[model samples]
Target: MDDDLHPDGAQDGREPRSGGANLLVFLALLPLDALVGGHAWLVVGMNGWAAAHNGEEATVPVTELVVSGGVPAAAGLALCWGRYWGAAVAQFALTAVLMAWLLSFQG
Candidate 1:
Protein backbone atom coordinates (compact mmCIF):
# COMPACT_ATOMS: atom_id res chain seq x y z
CA MET A 1 0.00 0.00 0.00
CA ASP A 2 1.09 3.62 -0.65
CA ASP A 3 0.30 4.29 3.06
CA ASP A 4 3.66 2.94 4.22
CA LEU A 5 5.94 5.02 2.01
CA HIS A 6 8.38 5.50 4.88
CA PRO A 7 10.51 2.65 6.21
CA ASP A 8 9.83 3.97 9.69
CA GLY A 9 6.09 3.39 9.21
CA ALA A 10 5.30 7.09 9.35
CA GLN A 11 2.56 7.98 6.88
CA ASP A 12 1.84 11.52 8.06
CA GLY A 13 -0.24 10.23 11.00
CA ARG A 14 -1.47 7.26 13.02
CA GLU A 15 -3.74 4.55 11.71
CA PRO A 16 -7.47 4.91 12.11
CA ARG A 17 -9.00 3.25 15.17
CA SER A 18 -12.09 1.09 15.13
CA GLY A 19 -15.18 2.21 17.07
CA GLY A 20 -15.44 -1.21 18.70
CA ALA A 21 -11.80 -0.98 19.78
CA ASN A 22 -12.48 2.24 21.63
CA LEU A 23 -15.60 0.89 23.22
CA LEU A 24 -13.83 -2.28 24.26
CA VAL A 25 -11.03 -0.27 25.84
CA PHE A 26 -13.55 1.87 27.71
CA LEU A 27 -15.31 -1.25 28.93
CA ALA A 28 -12.03 -2.75 30.05
CA LEU A 29 -11.03 0.35 31.97
CA LEU A 30 -14.42 0.90 33.65
CA PRO A 31 -13.72 -1.70 36.34
CA LEU A 32 -10.39 -0.08 37.17
CA ASP A 33 -12.00 3.28 37.77
CA ALA A 34 -14.80 1.68 39.73
CA LEU A 35 -12.27 -0.28 41.75
CA VAL A 36 -10.44 2.89 42.71
CA GLY A 37 -13.62 4.76 43.49
CA GLY A 38 -14.99 1.83 45.45
CA HIS A 39 -11.83 1.63 47.51
CA ALA A 40 -12.15 5.31 48.28
CA TRP A 41 -15.79 4.81 49.19
CA LEU A 42 -14.93 1.92 51.47
CA VAL A 43 -12.15 3.81 53.17
CA VAL A 44 -13.76 7.19 53.75
CA GLY A 45 -17.50 6.79 53.53
CA MET A 46 -17.89 3.34 55.01
CA ASN A 47 -15.17 3.57 57.63
CA GLY A 48 -12.73 1.11 56.05
CA TRP A 49 -12.39 -2.69 56.35
CA ALA A 50 -15.30 -3.22 58.66
CA ALA A 51 -17.75 -1.88 56.14
CA ALA A 52 -16.37 -4.07 53.41
CA HIS A 53 -16.46 -7.42 55.24
CA ASN A 54 -18.88 -6.95 58.13
CA GLY A 55 -21.51 -4.62 56.74
CA GLU A 56 -20.66 -1.93 59.22
CA GLU A 57 -22.60 1.27 58.83
CA ALA A 58 -21.04 4.24 57.11
CA THR A 59 -19.79 6.55 59.80
CA VAL A 60 -18.31 9.31 57.67
CA PRO A 61 -20.17 12.32 56.41
CA VAL A 62 -20.73 12.54 52.64
CA THR A 63 -19.08 15.94 52.27
CA GLU A 64 -15.95 14.71 54.01
CA LEU A 65 -15.79 11.60 51.87
CA VAL A 66 -16.16 13.66 48.72
CA VAL A 67 -13.47 16.05 49.82
CA SER A 68 -10.99 13.49 51.05
CA GLY A 69 -11.39 10.57 48.66
CA GLY A 70 -13.11 11.90 45.55
CA VAL A 71 -10.72 14.81 45.03
CA PRO A 72 -7.57 12.71 44.92
CA ALA A 73 -9.16 10.14 42.60
CA ALA A 74 -10.32 12.95 40.31
CA ALA A 75 -6.82 14.38 40.26
CA GLY A 76 -5.47 10.94 39.37
CA LEU A 77 -8.11 10.43 36.69
CA ALA A 78 -7.25 13.82 35.20
CA LEU A 79 -3.69 12.66 34.65
CA CYS A 80 -4.94 9.83 32.42
CA TRP A 81 -4.40 11.84 29.21
CA GLY A 82 -0.80 12.89 29.70
CA ARG A 83 2.68 11.40 30.21
CA TYR A 84 1.90 11.60 33.89
CA TRP A 85 -0.76 8.96 33.45
CA GLY A 86 1.56 6.53 35.22
CA ALA A 87 1.24 8.65 38.31
CA ALA A 88 -2.49 8.52 37.96
CA VAL A 89 -2.38 4.76 37.70
CA ALA A 90 -0.17 4.60 40.73
CA GLN A 91 -2.58 6.81 42.63
CA PHE A 92 -5.43 4.50 41.76
CA ALA A 93 -3.38 1.47 42.67
CA LEU A 94 -2.41 2.98 45.98
CA THR A 95 -5.76 4.49 46.93
CA ALA A 96 -6.88 1.78 49.30
CA VAL A 97 -3.67 1.05 51.16
CA LEU A 98 -2.68 4.69 51.35
CA MET A 99 -6.01 5.85 52.74
CA ALA A 100 -6.16 3.03 55.21
CA TRP A 101 -2.66 3.82 56.36
CA LEU A 102 -3.43 7.51 56.81
CA LEU A 103 -6.74 7.01 58.59
CA SER A 104 -5.09 4.63 61.01
CA PHE A 105 -3.20 7.60 62.41
CA GLN A 106 -6.45 9.31 63.35
CA GLY A 107 -7.99 6.31 65.06
Candidate 2:
Protein backbone atom coordinates (compact mmCIF):
# COMPACT_ATOMS: atom_id res chain seq x y z
CA MET A 1 0.00 0.00 0.00
CA ASP A 2 1.35 3.39 -1.05
CA ASP A 3 0.43 6.34 1.07
CA ASP A 4 0.07 9.70 -0.69
CA LEU A 5 0.73 11.65 2.47
CA HIS A 6 2.85 10.88 5.48
CA PRO A 7 2.89 12.78 8.74
CA ASP A 8 6.58 12.41 9.52
CA GLY A 9 8.26 12.93 6.15
CA ALA A 10 9.69 16.13 4.70
CA GLN A 11 8.89 16.59 1.05
CA ASP A 12 12.48 16.93 -0.15
CA GLY A 13 14.30 15.90 2.99
CA ARG A 14 15.23 19.53 3.43
CA GLU A 15 13.49 21.93 5.78
CA PRO A 16 12.73 25.37 4.45
CA ARG A 17 15.08 28.09 5.63
CA SER A 18 12.45 29.49 7.92
CA GLY A 19 14.88 31.69 9.77
CA GLY A 20 15.93 33.44 6.59
CA ALA A 21 12.39 33.55 5.25
CA ASN A 22 11.04 35.01 8.48
CA LEU A 23 13.88 37.48 8.62
CA LEU A 24 12.91 38.82 5.23
CA VAL A 25 9.34 39.21 6.33
CA PHE A 26 10.39 40.96 9.52
CA LEU A 27 12.65 43.35 7.67
CA ALA A 28 9.90 44.11 5.21
CA LEU A 29 7.47 44.93 7.99
CA LEU A 30 9.89 46.73 10.27
CA PRO A 31 9.00 50.15 8.93
CA LEU A 32 5.32 49.63 9.60
CA ASP A 33 6.00 48.41 13.10
CA ALA A 34 8.12 51.44 13.73
CA LEU A 35 5.30 53.64 12.60
CA VAL A 36 2.81 51.80 14.74
CA GLY A 37 5.06 51.97 17.77
CA GLY A 38 5.57 55.65 17.22
CA HIS A 39 1.86 56.22 17.04
CA ALA A 40 1.33 54.22 20.16
CA TRP A 41 3.80 56.44 21.90
CA LEU A 42 2.03 59.49 20.63
CA VAL A 43 -1.27 58.18 21.90
CA VAL A 44 0.23 57.64 25.30
CA GLY A 45 1.61 61.14 25.34
CA MET A 46 -1.67 62.66 24.24
CA ASN A 47 -3.60 60.78 26.85
CA GLY A 48 -1.16 61.95 29.48
CA TRP A 49 -1.59 65.49 28.27
CA ALA A 50 -5.32 65.19 28.39
CA ALA A 51 -5.22 63.94 31.92
CA ALA A 52 -2.93 66.76 32.96
CA HIS A 53 -5.17 69.40 31.46
CA ASN A 54 -8.44 67.73 32.41
CA GLY A 55 -9.38 67.58 28.72
CA GLU A 56 -11.89 65.18 27.30
CA GLU A 57 -10.40 61.70 27.26
CA ALA A 58 -13.10 60.13 25.16
CA THR A 59 -12.77 59.04 21.51
CA VAL A 60 -9.06 58.50 21.68
CA PRO A 61 -7.53 55.58 19.77
CA VAL A 62 -7.05 53.68 22.99
CA THR A 63 -6.78 50.28 21.30
CA GLU A 64 -7.53 50.96 17.69
CA LEU A 65 -3.93 51.39 16.72
CA VAL A 66 -2.88 48.41 18.74
CA VAL A 67 -5.34 46.05 17.15
CA SER A 68 -4.83 47.39 13.65
CA GLY A 69 -1.05 47.11 13.79
CA GLY A 70 -0.38 44.32 16.26
CA VAL A 71 -2.71 41.77 14.76
CA PRO A 72 -1.19 42.08 11.29
CA ALA A 73 2.37 42.00 12.51
CA ALA A 74 1.88 38.88 14.59
CA ALA A 75 -0.35 37.11 12.11
CA GLY A 76 1.84 37.99 9.16
CA LEU A 77 4.93 36.72 10.90
CA ALA A 78 3.28 33.45 11.78
CA LEU A 79 1.79 33.00 8.33
CA CYS A 80 5.04 33.85 6.58
CA TRP A 81 7.06 31.54 8.79
CA GLY A 82 4.53 28.83 8.06
CA ARG A 83 4.99 29.42 4.29
CA TYR A 84 1.45 30.56 3.78
CA TRP A 85 0.98 32.20 0.39
CA GLY A 86 -1.75 34.49 1.71
CA ALA A 87 0.54 36.22 4.12
CA ALA A 88 1.08 39.19 1.86
CA VAL A 89 -2.62 39.58 1.17
CA ALA A 90 -3.57 39.53 4.81
CA GLN A 91 -0.72 41.85 5.77
CA PHE A 92 -1.67 44.45 3.19
CA ALA A 93 -5.34 44.24 4.00
CA LEU A 94 -4.56 44.98 7.61
CA THR A 95 -2.27 47.76 6.43
CA ALA A 96 -5.14 49.30 4.51
CA VAL A 97 -7.29 49.24 7.58
CA LEU A 98 -4.53 50.80 9.61
CA MET A 99 -3.93 53.53 7.08
CA ALA A 100 -7.58 54.34 6.89
CA TRP A 101 -7.84 54.47 10.64
CA LEU A 102 -4.82 56.70 10.84
CA LEU A 103 -6.38 59.02 8.32
CA SER A 104 -9.54 59.05 10.38
CA PHE A 105 -7.48 60.27 13.29
CA GLN A 106 -6.08 63.08 11.20
CA GLY A 107 -9.54 64.53 10.77
Candidate 3:
Protein backbone atom coordinates (compact mmCIF):
# COMPACT_ATOMS: atom_id res chain seq x y z
CA MET A 1 0.00 0.00 0.00
CA ASP A 2 2.80 2.39 0.89
CA ASP A 3 4.62 1.45 -2.30
CA ASP A 4 1.48 2.01 -4.33
CA LEU A 5 1.12 5.44 -2.78
CA HIS A 6 4.80 6.44 -3.13
CA PRO A 7 5.08 4.85 -6.63
CA ASP A 8 8.89 5.30 -6.76
CA GLY A 9 9.55 3.76 -3.35
CA ALA A 10 10.81 7.14 -2.20
CA GLN A 11 9.41 6.72 1.30
CA ASP A 12 12.10 4.34 2.55
CA GLY A 13 15.04 5.04 4.88
CA ARG A 14 14.59 8.73 5.22
CA GLU A 15 13.46 11.05 7.98
CA PRO A 16 10.43 13.23 7.36
CA ARG A 17 11.36 16.69 6.17
CA SER A 18 10.76 19.48 8.64
CA GLY A 19 10.02 21.85 5.77
CA GLY A 20 7.14 19.69 4.63
CA ALA A 21 5.69 19.57 8.13
CA ASN A 22 6.10 23.31 8.54
CA LEU A 23 4.42 23.89 5.20
CA LEU A 24 1.51 21.74 6.22
CA VAL A 25 1.18 23.60 9.50
CA PHE A 26 1.35 26.89 7.67
CA LEU A 27 -1.27 25.83 5.12
CA ALA A 28 -3.63 24.59 7.80
CA LEU A 29 -3.32 27.63 10.05
CA LEU A 30 -3.34 30.32 7.39
CA PRO A 31 -6.89 29.82 6.10
CA LEU A 32 -8.31 29.72 9.59
CA ASP A 33 -6.52 32.92 10.51
CA ALA A 34 -7.61 34.55 7.26
CA LEU A 35 -11.24 33.64 7.79
CA VAL A 36 -11.39 34.99 11.31
CA GLY A 37 -9.34 38.03 10.40
CA GLY A 38 -11.55 38.76 7.39
CA HIS A 39 -14.70 38.50 9.47
CA ALA A 40 -13.24 40.86 12.05
CA TRP A 41 -12.32 43.36 9.36
CA LEU A 42 -15.74 43.09 7.76
CA VAL A 43 -17.50 43.71 11.01
CA VAL A 44 -15.32 46.67 11.77
CA GLY A 45 -15.78 48.10 8.29
CA MET A 46 -19.54 47.74 8.37
CA ASN A 47 -19.70 49.34 11.77
CA GLY A 48 -17.57 52.23 10.62
CA TRP A 49 -19.69 52.68 7.50
CA ALA A 50 -22.91 52.64 9.49
CA ALA A 51 -21.52 55.04 12.05
CA ALA A 52 -20.43 57.47 9.37
CA HIS A 53 -23.76 57.30 7.58
CA ASN A 54 -25.63 57.86 10.83
CA GLY A 55 -23.20 60.41 12.33
CA GLU A 56 -22.35 58.24 15.32
CA GLU A 57 -19.03 56.99 16.66
CA ALA A 58 -17.86 53.56 15.60
CA THR A 59 -18.32 50.96 18.34
CA VAL A 60 -15.27 48.86 17.58
CA PRO A 61 -11.91 50.46 17.09
CA VAL A 62 -10.02 49.55 13.90
CA THR A 63 -6.76 49.19 15.81
CA GLU A 64 -8.22 46.59 18.10
CA LEU A 65 -9.38 44.41 15.25
CA VAL A 66 -6.12 44.76 13.38
CA VAL A 67 -4.07 43.83 16.37
CA SER A 68 -6.28 40.93 17.34
CA GLY A 69 -6.72 39.53 13.84
CA GLY A 70 -3.79 40.74 11.81
CA VAL A 71 -1.09 39.59 14.18
CA PRO A 72 -2.19 35.98 14.18
CA ALA A 73 -2.70 35.92 10.42
CA ALA A 74 0.77 37.31 9.85
CA ALA A 75 2.24 34.89 12.37
CA GLY A 76 0.61 31.98 10.58
CA LEU A 77 2.13 33.05 7.27
CA ALA A 78 5.53 33.48 8.90
CA LEU A 79 5.28 29.93 10.21
CA CYS A 80 5.49 28.62 6.65
CA TRP A 81 9.25 29.20 6.74
CA GLY A 82 9.91 28.67 10.43
CA ARG A 83 11.55 25.70 12.15
CA TYR A 84 9.26 22.68 12.35
CA TRP A 85 8.85 22.24 16.11
CA GLY A 86 8.89 25.99 16.64
CA ALA A 87 6.17 26.49 14.11
CA ALA A 88 4.08 23.76 15.67
CA VAL A 89 4.43 25.28 19.12
CA ALA A 90 3.67 28.77 17.86
CA GLN A 91 0.68 27.47 15.92
CA PHE A 92 -0.81 26.01 19.09
CA ALA A 93 -0.03 29.10 21.15
CA LEU A 94 -1.38 31.49 18.55
CA THR A 95 -4.51 29.41 18.09
CA ALA A 96 -5.16 29.51 21.81
CA VAL A 97 -4.56 33.24 22.02
CA LEU A 98 -6.82 33.92 19.05
CA MET A 99 -9.59 31.78 20.46
CA ALA A 100 -9.37 33.44 23.82
CA TRP A 101 -9.45 36.89 22.30
CA LEU A 102 -12.46 35.96 20.19
CA LEU A 103 -14.30 34.44 23.10
CA SER A 104 -13.77 37.57 25.18
CA PHE A 105 -16.32 39.41 23.03
CA GLN A 106 -19.06 36.91 23.65
CA GLY A 107 -21.80 37.99 26.05
lDDT of each: 0.55, 0.59, 0.62
- lDDT by residue (tens digit), candidate 1, 7-96: 776675445445555445445555665665566556564465556578755354445544556655775666554334445565666565
The true-versus-predicted C-alpha distance at residue 57 of model 1, in Å, is: 16
Q: Residues 1-107, candidate 2, lDDT per residue (tens digit)?
A: 22543566534433444555645765676677667756765775576577658865434564666575665667666765567435455575666665565646543
* Best-fitting candidate, scored by lDDT: 3
Residue 47 Cα positional deviation in candidate 1, in Å, after optimal superposition: 4.7
Question: In terms of lDDT, which candidate is stronger, 2 or 3?
Answer: 3
TM-score of 2: 0.46
Give the candidate number with the greatest TM-score: 2
The C-alpha TM-scores of every prediction are 0.36, 0.46, 0.44
lDDT score, candidate 3, position 8: 69
RMSD of each: 10.2, 9.1, 8.7
Clashes of 1: 0
What is the C-alpha lDDT profile of model 3 across 1-107, one tens digit per residue? 77434766665544334766766776777777767666775676687788889997656654666566656656655654354555655665766675556445432
What candidate 3 gets wrong by more than 4 Å, as runs, is: 1-17, 59-84, 88-107
Worst 10 residues of 1 by lDDT: 57-66
